[model samples]
Target: MTTAMGAALRRIQLGNALSAFGNGFTIPYLFVYVSQVRNLGASTAGVVLATLAVAALLVLPLTGRVIDRRGPLPVAIAGTVSAAVGSLGLGFADSKVLVVAAAAALGAGFAVIQPALATMIVWCSTPTTRSRAFAMQFFLNNLGLGIGGLLGGQLVDPSNASSFVRLFAIESAMFLVLGVAVATVRLPKAPRLGDVVPAGEGAKGGWRSLLGDRAMVQLCVLGFVMFFACYGQFESGLAAFAVEVTRISPATLGIALAANTAAIVLTQFAVLRLVDGRRRSRVVALVGLIWTVAWIAAGVSGLVPGAHGVATALLISTYALFGIGESMLAPTVAPLVADLAPARLVGQYNSAFALVKQLAMAVGPAVGGLMAGGGMYGAYIVLLIVCALGITALALRLGRRLTPEQDNPRLLARRSEPVAGSAAAPAPVACSASH
Candidate 1:
């Protein structure tokens, strides 16, 4: 990379960390701030949460087209400004209507940020460095969230509405800072909508070309299941099971969560090295295996519920194992998304995948909540174990559809194959969707 590109990469990563930190402050506290601190009812708070999802869904399709047309930096700056405004509004809004409206703006902004930054990363890094670039992004993001949450927790007092307001203000400030940070980044010129063969074709063909690709669709399916089985369950299903079945205290749950974050923060680099030269599909498959063990450990924790010490240890182990799977995925799935897209269409592809994730997250909680059912009959454990195993099966299936270049990028690096310019870009894999 050139010196300019290196500086740009650093700025992007720093901006990402700051933005994540800002979100961490507000995201965890939203329900409490809305339902109790703001004196709105639980139903209203739930509406606010749902509004975020709705706004993302409404805006993401449009966002993809705009990114492909206008490039990611402008869109990202716009999103940052929107989020800052929404954060300030949410901080002070007393009425449920205002709260929901603020959430809508925040959600739309959040939706755009993913694809915009992803595209920026693509522009700044060559394929050889892309996986590691994304891994570093993931690591910094988690670190920022953990620290932000810790600080927010320290400053917040449920009894004091002003404390919550102060937290939101701080989050708003972070967003504004991130906006300034992103504005300073200089990206390399790449294909935009205007550069495509036909002026209007890029816009119309963006989603069509993406959806027409069998492998991309399959990967999206696999991604959806991956998120639904794990991330979806983290706070609602798994936490509920720990509390109701394992009979663990809330403090223990906190410890388990801390263990999860700690495991990722500590081990991400090591895991990145391990994944560096391997097939991305195989790394993902390994994540499935790791998470399989995690689910079994989760089951073990609840099996002998009366043994509190044993259950607590096993539960913490479960979270650590999930953390390991997360670490592996950080370098695998995201880079694969970049590799699959036509250079001009990276933003659309990222947006589509992010859409899949949001959908799974939205649905996962409901399914997990139902499955938790106070941990009756071990249903939740059995279901998640199957999901983990399913992840492995799906990964291997997706592997068959991937080009070797897509599956293992390091081979290109090792052979000194050029990873830039139109000639250097690998051809899309030719494979049927039939499974």
Candidate 2:
């Protein structure tokens, strides 16, 4: 990468970390802020949360087309400004209607930001560096959120509504900072919609071309299951099981969550090295195996409920195990999406994948909540375990559809290596996806 590109990526990552820090302040407190602090009932709080999802769904499809047409910079800046307005509105909005509306704006802003930032990273880094770039992004995001949550927790008092307002105001300020930082970034000239698609066809042709890539479609399917099985269960199925079945306290659950983040923050670089030069598909398969054990550990925790100490330890380990799997995925999944995408269509692919994730986040919670709420805890554990194993199956299947260079990018670097005792470069390796 050139110096300019590196500088742009650094600025983007810094801004991303700061924005995530602000988002963290609200994440842990949003439910409480809406349901109790704002004096809105639990039902209203539910609506606010649902509204966020609805807003994302409404925005993501169009977001991709706009990014592809106008470039990620403007899209990213627009998103941050919208998010700032939403965050600031939430700070002072006490009524349920106002809260829900604010959430809609925030959600839409977030939906746009994710794909926009991802495309920017894709543009800034070459394929060889892309995996590490995304890994670093994931690591920073988690670290920022972790610190912000810790400090925000220290400052918040449920009895004082003004404290919550102050938290939201700080969040708004960070978003504006993100917008300013992004505006300073100078991206390489990007392909416009017309450059990628024929004049008359427009966005539909782009979508059709995207859907035609068998590997991408399979990855999207795999993405849904992956998110549904693990991330979907984090605060819903798994937390409920820990509380109701294992009979662990909410405070303990918080500790387990911290363990998850700590595991990611501490081990990310180590895991990055470990997975480097390896096949991304097999790496993802390995993550499935890890999560399989995580789900089983969670199940065992519930079964040994009589021994509270044992149960709590098992549950905490379960979360830590999930964290380890997450570390593995950080370098694999997103890079694969970029590799599959045509260079001109990177934004579209990123947004489509983000849409899939949001769908899983929406559906996973609803299904898990039903199972946990209905006291079908045993079934829930079994279902998630099956989904985990399915991830492995799906990955290996997708591997067959990937070019060697796409599946294992290190081979590209190896192919480009200087031949021993030779002045001239080695012959280019002929690789096939199907082979």
Candidate 3:
């Protein structure tokens, strides 16, 4: 049984890694492809990327509903196929309309895929093992991202537009193959609809039930802020900063990204093993602090005029530290989301979490760019302040909600024990309506 469990985990991890690789392949070069190759300005490219985030936010609720009804495997297959089609179309698109359409399609597909993937991970593990399972997924995802970034840097030659287009074609093929892979795998049946009994009563009351829970609400808020700050630094600002502030060649930038990815991949399991169910909010808070410091370091490094090599090294180290914090925080957040969610609305709960993140990713860049106009240091300072505030908020909220007794594993184990004469509760019904 243990061996079988391990094998199942291995399969899921491999699938996640492959899926993430396919998903990440285009991101490293997307802005460059849009701006330099397509002749769109940086602001325009940012808007295009933001459009993807908007699509994701708009699509996720509907996708979550579909996953609740049809199960994750079918949704995963559809999402992967859609992503492939979109990416392939992107290769052929010359006009802004076509590009935005393709980007929207890609974003929609990814949005559909995320909730299903997360649901599958949850389904495959016991609560005790969920954090580690997610950690493994995160590790492989980051590793694949690093590898994809490195490969993209090599593949995307500005002098040869054909080469860049070919890379997109290859990315399209990978997505298609991954879709098939997901389709081939057998997944567990989804929980029955309407199975969850809400703490309150009324139609559409499930949402109110979820919102009424202070802990869950706070978790969602923390998630929003964390992603808002992190994405602003890593996704929007990091590459541009590397190009402008550091004199490192594009190849070296890729290496530095690879190093950041390596830190996430290698350290995730170790961090997961060390942290487990204990001090989850504290761990998240610490991650925020680490990220803030990393941003500060990166900003400070930029102030070292003309020492581009040293500055670049410091910047990479800063990103590496951010990666480490992310490695710790990412896996922890999912399980907490699951735990805090009412049993009946897990899909909705997960979708809400994704929504917060998508919203953050969508809006963070424009704000970051505005602050960063002064310089990289200005951007870094803004990020640092955001992280610090986010951490403080999370700590205070979590501290008030979680008691020392609840934090004690032995106490939790005892609390979880069913009363001697209690009837076995029926499982919550899964709602199937499209969002």
Q: Of the candidates shown, which would achieve the greatest lDDT relative to the real structure?
A: 2
Candidate achieving higher TM-score, 2 or 3: 2
How much lDDT does candidate 2 score? 0.89
lDDT string for model 1 (1-435, tens) is 555666777888898898888777877889989999999999999999899988998888878788877889899999988888888889899998899999998888878888898888887777778888899999999899989988889999999988988988888888878777778876656674554535567656888899899999999999999999889999789999888878889988988998998999999999998888899888899889999999999888888877889999999999999988998998889989999988778888889998999899999888888777754538778889999999999999999999888899877776765555736646321211111
**Candidate 2 per-residue lDDT over residues 22-107, each given as its tens digit:** 98898899988989988898899899889989999999988888888789989999999889989888889989879988999899
Error of 2 at 31 (Å): 1.0
Candidates in order, TM-scores: namely 0.93, 0.95, 0.83
lDDT (0 to 1) per candidate? 0.85, 0.89, 0.70
In order of lDDT, best first, we have: 2, 1, 3
lDDT (10s digit) by residue, model 3, range 371-410: 5565654645666667756775686677579655433233
What lDDT score goes with residue 81 in model 2? 89
Ranking by TM-score: 2, 1, 3
Clashing pairs in 1: none
Question: Which 10 consecutive residues of model 1 have the lowest summed lDDT?
Answer: 426-435
Runs of candidate 1 exceeding 4 Å displacement: 192-197, 374-377, 417-435
The TM-score of candidate 3 is 0.83
- Deviation of model 2 at 276, angstroms: 0.5
Q: For candidate 3, list the clashing residue pairs, or say none.
A: 192-430, 193-429, 193-430, 194-429, 194-430, 195-428, 195-429, 196-428, 196-429
